[model samples]
Target: MSMQDTLDTASRKLLERAAPGRVDFENLVVVPLFAVVAALILGALTMLATSVEPATIGRSYLALLQGSVGSLAAISETLTAAAPLILAGLGLALGFRAGLFNIGAEGQILMGGMAAVICGFSFSHLPFAVLMPLCVISGGAAGAFYASIAGWLRAATGAHEVITTIMLNMISYRLVDYMLRLPWVQRPGRADPISQSVPPNAELPALLQWLDPNLRLHAGIFLTLLAVVVVYWLLFRTKLGFEFRASGASPEAARYAGMRASLIIVLAMATAGMLAGLAGANQVLGVLGRASPGFSAGIGFDAIAVALLGRSHPVGVLFAGLLFGALEAGGRQMQVDAGVSIDLIGIIQALIIVFIAAPLLVRALFPWGFRRPDSGDGRS
Candidate 1:
């Protein structure tokens, strides 16, 4: 089978397994949980092999737990980090369901954020009620239009989304840099490729600032939650979503069923782009308050792993995003409190993804925990 066909099969299986009374329990919950545990255990082993002291290792782990959930401050940090991740991951998850590997979220984030920043500052006179929504809408629209380029290419010229999206990512990096240099966008007296601050009225209101002004958690979390519900409804309830799934399952069959394959491809890509754009807005409007070089900070790329661990399901993505967020928040404390290298967190994350992708290896390592997917009995 072709690569697209293979991807479609994988996506279909993922969707099937996500359903009630399906393989969802094994693949979605059990496997991801074990993958995380195994990665952590291996991370400890790596520390031991590196001659790190056992006391230090224990302290590092303790610090990690404390930083992630020990207090309200840590929870705020984790939620702040997770907002953009969950937004971006949901978009990518939608694309995956449609058999589109649109990895250009980084680019989409950049362009969308730039657009929202422009809207925020340009319409500074508008009230917060109007301006905030305007900035968000502009961001989503920009992302959708940007992503549609690859979708259009695929529909019109048979260009693969993987190649096109990667190329778009490269182009977007330079494009943002160029835009930042424009006098209108550039901050006064700043030679660096950074933008002027977005207007205060356009910023997403801090959710926890009433309790602590330093809290980064913002109303963006609400937006992220809303997107999750919308995506769930779209993918499982709407006829358009069925069409998207149908196309992914078998393009030929979808065409035979009279679905507009070209339109579906473009719409799917554009929809994913919109979500990514919203993520960009969440970053700029809720957190950064402006644009800069590499402002997205690889959130787009990391979201790919989030989507994978979530099994491309909206609810799954939510939990996965939060888990990754906790890891990030905890990793910082691990470094500061225990003087452990933050790189260990990266190693653990990589190992988790490796284990997630290779479930058979995890099953082999812990045979008692998992049943074979095809087995009716408990035996593998």
Candidate 2:
């Protein structure tokens, strides 16, 4: 071949290899952020429709900020909220990366919480050294086992995870309803569905010791951050991460390369479930001090939103969890201080997800509403 031809061929190979990753990264960053920005706009419009005063949004938001961080107690509560969200969001992101949607996190949380409570209450005379690890493992195992069913179905039969996970979620609610009230699981002589509190030594320590005792923030937030770093490392810096992404994007291509697609699906769900279980364990051992119905507070579902908002990246999920935690902590204040319906929070969340997933719809509609589609509303 001619020297010029050889040089051109080499340059083209390098260019192809270099360009896609950079362009892909840009898409990853912008799409999710744009979704969030659009959601806020839609949320603001919703508030205006409700006839809320202009300053009310500002006042409520400030109050929320004060509650979330201005004081020790608020900060504690904010961290507590973020703890479960981080774990749950990580779980969802993992599943997404493996082309599975483990929507059954709520159920997994239930089982994990139940497992932790059982370990905490049943075990006697154990030192804190053993007790903590025991609780963590048992909880994660419970969630892993719960999620495995959906994974098994997907592996065995081409079952769509979306359907299986949702079905399992329903089944989990019923199972929890039955188990929390069991003679062994329930609080003695009480009709309430709460379980006995975790042992004091078994509880996680609050990391911000400088904060006043009035604060409720525990060590769980640090752990959640740790999980984020680990997930990022796993997803981007490791061979397993590569396999997970490849399997997710194209199963056939993965099979062509001799990757074990089914095994990856099972292992991926197991990993995701383990994180979710840890969230359940955190609620019991750190924040709630016991198992309670609705302890997760739909954080599992919210994690999906967080994963989407964060573009399923670990760093994105952490920030997304914190943002949602802040919104949740502030939302009550928004309602009480501004008389805005708490329902508005739900509306805002839905709008954010909708707008983020479909920004083109907003851009196009607004313009016609801006240029082409505004055809006199089909009127004369």
Candidate 3:
């Protein structure tokens, strides 16, 4: 054979060897894993820089694991922490798929919780079957209405959702504060701003109370799971979902294809708001039993990270929520057992985001794992 023919044969062999390195499920899984690992290593280094001992770092991580899932009770706590996160993350993920940056979930959640609380207290005499569904629906509706405002502005006035949603969030904080102080909403004879507690009949039943009354895990977990299934089906199998994805991927192209760009935007934002509302409802009816100032506790904000970490996929969001929940639950343990600051968890999370967002860093750190397949001409 001629020299050119030999080179071509060699190129084919090289390409074959590199083919397995192309992006796929294995690469997807490994990339995130590496990101997490890198973040953890950086965290350890940070701890050492702060004069923390290596043994303390080890103990801190062990305590984190123990607090998150060391036993059945710990596992339950992790799940409880994850419940609202999963719901809110799903909402954010849906909005992301539709090309909307819905930063107003925090506001929508507050409105939903307020609506649910009102419904729960106003109809205290209703039967459980009647009241529970009503409360949930009311919360969702309130959230939808709140979110629709941003959507409307985006469609009708060409306002950006990011700006509108942020403004709306600030408005919601004051709104909820004012609402909580109202005589009818506030607990009778109470000086502090707090809403009346949800009636027993309206409260969501604990899912694993039989195992332990201390376990806070509630039926909201089921709700979150059901939402995952519904979202997955809607995004992959339905016509509206197609419109949402299409419009998100390219508004100009979708408009050219005869899709109603405005309508899709409105519907997507409304749906996302409804889901966020349910998360607020879950927190009030299932956990807190009442509303107060800052009741959301930043779950809406954390949900953005969860959605990003999950790649805006429903199933991915579920697992990402769980991971974040573990971090939250474990942070307390790390603080107690190892005398490490719980803020370390936040640092680790931020690092993970940074690493994930910059895949080239990860690729550079582990070149073999991400090496592109060679072309026939030996080009990457």
Candidate 4:
């Protein structure tokens, strides 16, 4: 064979190795696991660099494990934290799959919480069945509306979602702050800028309150699971989902194939906002029972990492959310038991994202693990 022919064959092989049409089981499982391990190893090294004792580093990790799942109560706390992350991550994943970047989930969450609080306090006489659904619906609608503003701009005015959504996030912060201080929304007797508590009927019932009233785990867990299943079905088993995927993969081709790109963009963003709004409702109705400034606690922002680490897959997002939840729940324990700064957890999370984003680096770090079994010679 000519040298040029050999070079062409080598290039084709390299391309095949680097970019598979679909992720194989090995890549799906091994890549994320390896990235997490690499992050942990680097995190340990970072601790050592900061003058933390080796033994203390070990104890901090152990405390993290115990805090996340050591006991039934710890497991419950992990799940509680995971619930909002999963819901919001799923929303962001949906937008990603539709070729849209929605950085406005934080604002949507705030709007949803504000709407739910307003509904909850205004209809104090409604029955549980009526009040609960009303609050949830209001929250979702409010979120959808808020997110649609950015989507409409993207579709109609050619504005980029990243810039628009980021601006929207800042707007939401100021908007919520103003709303909380209003005479009708604020607590009746207190001057604090907090909303009135949700009525009992409007609150989500704790699933395990019978075991212990202090357990904050609630029916929102079931809602989050249901959302995962629904998103999966929507993405893989429907015509609209096919359109979303096609548009994401190639907008020009989807347009040539007669897909309405504008409609899909708006619809996808609206759907994403609705899911994020539900997350806000879950926080307020299921946990806090009222709206306060900064109640979102950066769940919307962390959800971006969750979506990326999950590779925009619904099932992947669910597991990633759980993992992050465990880290968050354990960080407190590590701080208390091992005298380590909780900021270490943030560093680990950042490292994980960096590794996941650099697949080539991960592959280079674990060559033996990523190596594919050779087929018969001359097969190609």
Candidate 5:
């Protein structure tokens, strides 16, 4: 064929190739949103199937909104829940960026809270000036160390992080339970597993106490924002960040490019663990003010949904966390107001993941409502 004719064929092929990736991208973005909408619709259907009216779900949904964000006190409670979610989800999201799935946020959180409690109760003489930072740092460090074990295993052996991290989560629960049962940690003569209240100095400053004691929003929200910024910087700016991302994208390619893949893996896990631990610490400092049995209430698991729903973007994760927090905090009112099943939230979460994971299905269904990505390479 003539060179000109060959070029024409190549260009046509390139255009065809480009169409799919572009369609896929649009599909990805639109599918998840549609999935959420579909999930809610499914939930309504479920309500009807269970002998509850579809209006029961919507009625409770509205009440849940009112209880979570309606008044000043409600808004504060929402923020309070959002704070820890922001921290924990960011941690999990970072791990995802580095191709590491550090699923031990629960344990990391427990250790962080336990460490914060230890610092708070022990440093009774320290002024709020010193005590708060001390609690924060100690909590983060405790979580980091706890996560390092899984990192070490991944680096040294071919062990998958999902397994080790999950195992560690269980261990952390038992360890924290044992520690809280100690006479020094537990309140004297208290039959409960709860620790003593953190010193008032260790408590985070509430943002709007003037509104009401029920307005439990605290300065930890600021800390969560700081964490998001810092994670964003580390992922895109510094050389170390580049190494972490490179390893995550392709470990072999990173090694070929002379990057330390193993080290990056360990650091990524450590960083993720630290964030999760800080979340736990926030629980203690901002809301709980003490560690107890089942303190996290499965926030770690909920954080996974937050990360996936946000596509692992820092800003996206923050908003997703808040949304989940709203759903969680509002669930109580949903149950109370409309007598709807609390399981509806989980139903929605599952549906969102399903749509996100298989976006093609969504695009097939929402033909006019979505889009896809593009790739321009051509060689047939």
Candidate 6:
């Protein structure tokens, strides 16, 4: 071919590669789906190896499925569990998109929850509409402020976020413990670490109490869904998101483009912290109704896995959170109904992560799974 023709062909290929919606479908969708399947298969094998009878194994799996989605109560539990995970995972995913590893969500969640709970009990006389929003805003703002400390440290002192956030987590735990022990913060007449119960008006209203008062599902799920939408828009439809993506992809190039690195780092961390704080607030206001030691329930740590499983995408985080929530809700049923250990669910989750991390291994096992018939580049 002539030199001009060769240049034109190269330009067309570059444009095609850069076009929107051109993400690799196999890696994005198929890999994760198959990883789940693989994990389930391995979990079943684990049961057999542990001397579980084949029939009992089948029953355990059946109970798991039923408990997650078979009945109204099951669906409610799944949604209730999913709401917090989705919120926290969205925060972590946002950090991932900005090339930052924010591991202090545990501290942020604790701070946020405590802030909301304090708001809840202190303003018991306020109307629901006024008090609820006030508590939520306080939770988010507290989390943002606490997280910004780490961000500012990283920006100004050249400190690594991983180290700073971990230290913050430890500090937060002690700080929360101290707060809960104070005479004014602790529940009156109770010596335990628990805070006073939030007023009824401050609680997140149950979404399905009229249909079944036993359901724990609440309006927080709607907020979680709204956060998903907002994060999606923030990541894909905003100029700030472009800067974040650019910085993550190539810090040198972003700097050359005149984007302020320190500002982006601090803002990204603050945004992630805000979401995490909201998750904590949701738990306190929507479910727990108070703050205590471990009130965050390690949701912050689980959020890392959720963000990874979701490939750091907002929509993906939503679905991944729901799946993890189903596993949690169903694991209880499996244990109660079939006498299976709840640890089995943990094994499955670990296996899924392993498979997801090793896509080449999955592709090797299913060589034809991701190949396109007409495309010779070896991807669908």
| lDDT values for all models | 0.92, 0.79, 0.88, 0.89, 0.81, 0.90
- Model 2, residue 138: distance off in Å is 1.2
Candidate 3 vs 4: which has more lDDT: 4
Error of 5 at 68 (Å): 3.4
Provide the lDDT at 172 for model 1.
94
The predictions' CA RMSDs to the true structure, in order, are 4.9, 7.9, 4.6, 2.8, 4.5, 3.8
Off by over 4 Å in 6: 1-23, 372-380
- 2 versus 5: better TM-score goes to: 5
Estimate candidate 4's alpha-carbon lDDT, on a 0 to 1 scale: 0.89
Point out where model 4 deviates above 4 Å. Answer: 1-22, 372-380
Model 5, residue 183: distance off in Å is: 1.6
The candidate with the higher lDDT, 2 or 3, is: 3
lDDT of 2 at 111: 83
Question: Which window of 10 residues has the lowest lDDT sum in candidate 4?
Answer: 371-380
> How do the residues 324-379 of candidate 2 rate in per-residue lDDT, one tens digit apiece?
77777767767777777888778777876786567566555444322232222222
Off by over 4 Å in 2: 1-31, 69-72, 208-210, 359-380
lDDT of 3: 0.88
The candidate 6 region of ten consecutive residues with least summed lDDT is 371-380
Q: Scored by Cα lDDT, where does model 5 land?
A: 0.81
Error of 5 at 375 (Å): 14
161-187, model 4: which lDDT tens digit per residue? Answer: 999999999999999889999999999
lDDT for position 320 in model 5: 78
- Assess candidate 2 and give its TM-score to the true structure: 0.86
Q: Compose the digit string of candidate 1's lDDT tens values, residues 49-125.
A: 99999999999999999999989999999999998889999999999999898899999998899999999999999
lDDT of 3 by residue, 169-199 (tens): 9999999999999999999989898999999
How far residue 366's Cα lies from its native spot in candidate 2, in Å, is: 11
For candidate 5, write residues 299-377 as lDDT tens digits. Answer: 8887887787777778878877787777767776788788777887677667777777776777676767842222224
